[model samples]
Target: MDTAERTLIDPTHFREVMGHYPTGVAVVTGVVDGEPVGMVVGTFSSVSMDPPLVAFMPQVGSRTWDRLTLAPALCVNVLAHDQLELCRTMAVPRPDKFDGVDWVPSTLGAPVLTDAVAHVHCRQQSVVEAGDHWIVLCAVEGMEVTRPATPLLFFQGGYGGFSPAGMAAKADAELITAVRLGDRARPQVERLASRLECEAAALVAISPDELTTAVSAYGGSATMVEPLGQRVPLIPPIGEAYVAGAAPEVVERWLAKVGPNEPGLVECYRSRLAAVAERGVALSMVGPGARSDYQRLHEALAEYASGELTPARERAVRTVLAQTRHFFDELDVLPDETYDVGAVVVPVHGPDGRVAMVLRITQLPAGMPGRVVNGWIEELRTAAGCVERDLVGRGAQQASDYRDWWEADFPM
Candidate 1:
């Protein structure tokens, strides 16, 4: 912690360590000589409330800072997550940084960038010389929160956005509640379970890591038991229906984290995903072998859910799941010999066209004829379509209700 010890830590090491802290991105803009001038700064901070003060640090060598400091007032425009390109435009040295950029003048005549999350208009207050940078302080004269949006974040030498954990938890809860309170789909899934004499379950994507069984109707003879709220890893066979229609980047991220690097396995997964997309459903054979594997997997997952597994065991189970990718391939492809027990999953799309939930039927009896299996598949697809249509209808109704309320409240 001494100066000499600190000096021993190289600049690269210091930067890498400090990069763990996330900061918001903002652009300091002003009007000088009847032209728009701006520069990006990542170190903007609020200093005081009573006096209404704000501060930002600019590198002493920045030519833009030299010109910006001459202006009588400055406007700090906090960038939104969608304004990354604007940040880049003001980052490098350029003669006309405002070229093709949209802006308007604030009360103090400082350029306020359009679509910014907020703007703080301030008058020049003071400056202090900090090592290799100038700490420019300003007195806030006016401010406005232009819009509500996700703030752009800078961390670990990259740009990102924030999603509150509480919001995600609330969203998950709402999705579960929706599944349970469904008038159209929940009853349909129950009827399907009764007709097929198999367990029919609804699975929702709770997070990128796992899917939660929101609701299930047991057919009394289901060999496997997936209770309500049971969470399972977003792995194949169990989660292929959700993954099949997910965004490419999302699928890639999931694979990079948990998928094996073997090319053959990757190719197999690709083919399975392609087939799921083409056929609009996912199928998995649940013979005696698969049932045993699933039973053990379910036990391990339950232990994980209860936080009873040690770190080593958790890792071991994850590895096992990744290595068993081959077991989930071409599940819909019927074998030369008929096998008892299989699962057919159909995805239910939400208002955004993303797969919000899946309807799955498990534990088909052995010696079932091909025609019967095909019939089951068609029936599952029809059920999924019904659920999707119902969800869309509900979403449209809610939107219309909101519009009516807004019109009544505003009377304009």
Candidate 2:
């Protein structure tokens, strides 16, 4: 059978068939005449990672696509679930699409939707004409993620989610910050926030109104508070600092100056809370270490919340929780080994043209608090050059030195 003839399905019938597949909504934006312009698309997708690239299909008849061609670059904004109306409005060919939307232009003159779940600003790399659409491709040159949250999806003939609990990938650096918070120093949380340059404004994971109300009590202002979703805080400059790879000294200094008691950290949190007021999602981890930690906690919570925590798993979790709680209760009396025993992992590039471990510290059977104090001595030995010392001997001293460095750099 000829292809067209054999598959002569009616257009109305095909709508029912095609509507089963779910797709995400995104907006392709760029600047024209110094004013921002954009059109929403349901087909935007990431195409490559090594040399970052993305692709989207724009209807051949779209005027927004036509205007987009004039710009040398463009930005793709991934809409969140709450942005359904925003997507619907931009999807149509509106003369002033930015009427109710907020955005800013990028270095390449692309319109980037403010605080999209994720956005990529890129320069036009190439384009190809498909049957009824144009395949727009671009090479990513710059990007910024305001926060980590669920992406809005569109599929079939209606809007929906592929999975019951939508999932997303988060930045790795943010995950580290969330793990640090597991230390449960909530009493001095404001102080922790200062040391970290950010604090998590969280509420009981329940209803939106309740969450925000609780958050407000904790000195956090709530905005677009979702009933059941992870809403991370946005700590600027500090959050952006992580992405820029700021110097350790700068980060440490900032950490030292900000904290619960300090006006600077408190002001930073309050300022962000006020900015996001009643918008999309409230209760962000603003400031101290906003960017990364906010992302990590959101992802972890989203993942855990979406799935049913089995009784066995719940029991195990509770056990760990209790253990951690007990550790904190007796934190002062805890043996040095109990407090410090792990290696501080850092990502670095080495002489082999690949990343290699530069240093590590381990606890010893000996009762010496030497892990932090003597650890520095061993590190100095390496300063001269690689000293061929046994793991046991080096770990005891180096581990202590590592603690000292951390204390000096980010004293609690």
TM-scores for all candidates: the values are: 0.51, 0.43
> Against the true structure, candidate 2 has what lDDT?
0.45
Residues 23-55, candidate 2, lDDT per residue (tens digit)? 888888888777777888888888999889889
Error of 1 at 117 (Å): 48
Error of 2 at 82 (Å): 1.2
Task: Quote the positional error of residue 329 for candidate 1 in Å.
Answer: 2.2
Cα shift from native, residue 188, model 2 (Å): 32
Tell me the tens digit of each residue's lDDT in model 1 across 286-379. Answer: 5556667766666666754543333445566676666555446545545345645457888877666766678888866766755677778888
Q: What is the lDDT of residue 62 in candidate 2?
A: 79
Pairs that collide in candidate 1 are none
TM-score of 2: 0.43
* Global lDDT scores for all candidate models: 0.74, 0.45
Worst ten in a row by lDDT for model 2 = 205-214
RMSD of each: 19.3, 20.8
